[model samples]
Target: MIRVLIVEDEPLIAEAHRTYVQRVTGFVPVGIAHSGRAAMRAVADAAAYGTPIDLVLMDLGLPDTSGLEVAAALTGVTPSPDVIAITSARDVAMVRTAVAHGVVLYLLKPFTFAAFRDKLDHYREFRASLPSNNDTTVSQHEIDRALSALRTTDLRASTPKGVAPQTLDEISRAVRAAPEGVTAADTATNVGVSRITAWRYLEKLAEDGLVTRRSDYGRAGRPKTRYLWKTKHAN
Candidate 1:
């Protein structure tokens, strides 16, 4: 299995990344770090213990320092782990800098399970295409094939059938606006939809990993199910 380390400042987001990593067949989340320093310590400790991490799912907005700085520092360590940047930043200059700092892949925020899985799967393919022996010299065709494995098609058009993108956007906005979480009824009122309609969309969001579901038992009678947006995103 490929060992992975999750580095995100937010506890919930870090846990979500850990869960997502575990869901992939060949990946295992070995640790989670909430800061750049913690991430460096975890990587060093893993190396010291003789079980070095193979990959890092790095979040760019680290509290202690920029995630790009962390990535650059990580490269100085022997047998550095590959980084796949997971962030909300879309600045072209940031992307260029991340590439210079050795980020193998870039995944934007508010992504679904399908999109996340696509990236991991592509990385696996890329790794598989590489030569197993360190001393082996690769040909031009072999190099091309390995690099091609990292390419991914656009997944923005991949929403499930019967779900309108406009309505999904509205539901996402409503959930993000409510940091405390929202019930289907609350979402319905906010989005101008029926309770049942809101429930269906919320379920789809939960299934896609964009939102999390929990039971609210404080109220009388049956517990109400609430859905929360997984991360904070710009409107």
Candidate 2:
């Protein structure tokens, strides 16, 4: 689960945001902070307990310092979590300021679920593809592809890897054979390959809007990510 800290001053808005986060498949609403100062305390407490907050859903107009100021403060600390500014502030200057402070995505308020889900799915893909190597270097093509993936909002338009399209068919066959929802590990077993290879194919399906991923809750050491065929995509 992506542990999230929501910073919103209004009780109703905070609750609404919390509910939305809970409704998502992979997000977990760890706590709510009604003010910038309260946000700091909650994050500090979580960090002290070793359950580091993975992300912050910040609202710019906070009771304390501006949300940008709160983000700036938290980001200067060790192991800063990713910040995505979720606020009604739409002025270009404020958006620029949020981006200047390293906010990944600045979401304007009053969006429908479809628009919100699309942005979130892009973020999920981007996070999943983050570099694991110590070297910060990458090829131009890799950078271009990664950035393009983030800007893409249409699920019908996502491109899969350069591998043969037959891989998709093979995946469908393998998953269809199983009565239960399949994990990448399961696909890897069926295809005689490593789990990481399996994950790439499954993620491609997710990108193509053929599959939906959900956290496998209950009876597990770690939350295993599972993929279920979206009903509309099944043949």
Candidate 3:
């Protein structure tokens, strides 16, 4: 499993991020740190326990110091964790600095669960493509695919002729809000669209790798194909 440490000053936002991390498959929240100092301490404590943290969701603004400085400090750690900036800071210069400091992903604030999950999913794919054993040299094709996984593919560009982006967003929101997951009929009712229209949006999301479709066998007759948000890490 991928152990994650959340470094955010805001308590509520940190809690929300913790929840988001739990929803993904292959990842688990190791601990939360409200400041840079606390983050370093948490990292040490995790290492002491023998399970070092694998990833860090770092907010650029911290009460003690800037997240960039924290990232620099982590460079000297014995088992350093990969950092992903999760902050509202959109300054290009700050982003460039973060990239220089070894941040793998930069996620903007006020994002939906779908967007958040997409980032982590991409990260997972990138990590999965790495050499399972260090001795094996990475082939050029493997290297290219791993790097490509980190880049977000624009799902909007692939939208079919008739589906409106607004409708798709609405359908995505409805499904994401449903923790137990939602079917096309449920999405249709929530978004006030026809079942077929809702299914079209759900299918689009699934095709874009933002959602999952499964067979619901609970009901007696004709097992309905249920469309659910794919927020969890896949096995």
Predicted model with the maximum TM-score: 3
| Per-model lDDT | 0.86, 0.75, 0.84
In the range 111-218, model 1's lDDT, one tens digit per residue, is 987668768877887788888665799999788888777765442465778888667767876886688999999999999999999999999888777689999998
Candidate 2 global Cα RMSD:
12.1
**Candidate 3 TM-score versus the reference:** 0.71
Q: Candidate 1, overall lDDT?
A: 0.86
Off by more than 4 A, model 1: 157-235
- Residue 15, candidate 2: Cα error in Å is 0.8
**On residues 1-235, what C-alpha lDDT tens digit does candidate 2 reach at each position?**
7898999999998898888887666788999999999998888888888887878989989987899988988876555677888888878898889988878777779865544555565566566555745367877866765565466334333444464445555675465446476899999888876898788888887866767788987685888888886533422
What shift in Å separates residue 207 of candidate 2 from its native position after superposition?
A: 16
Clashing pairs in 1: none
Q: How do the residues 1-235 of candidate 3 rate in per-residue lDDT, one tens digit apiece?
A: 8999999999999999999999987899989999999999998888778888889999989999999999988878867888999988888998899999999899999887767877887788788888756478988988887877788654556778998866876787687677678888888899999999998889888877778888989757988877776543232
Q: Looking at candidate 3, what is the lDDT of residue 21?
A: 95
- TM-score, per-candidate, Cα-based: 0.66, 0.61, 0.71
Count backbone overlaps in model 3: 2
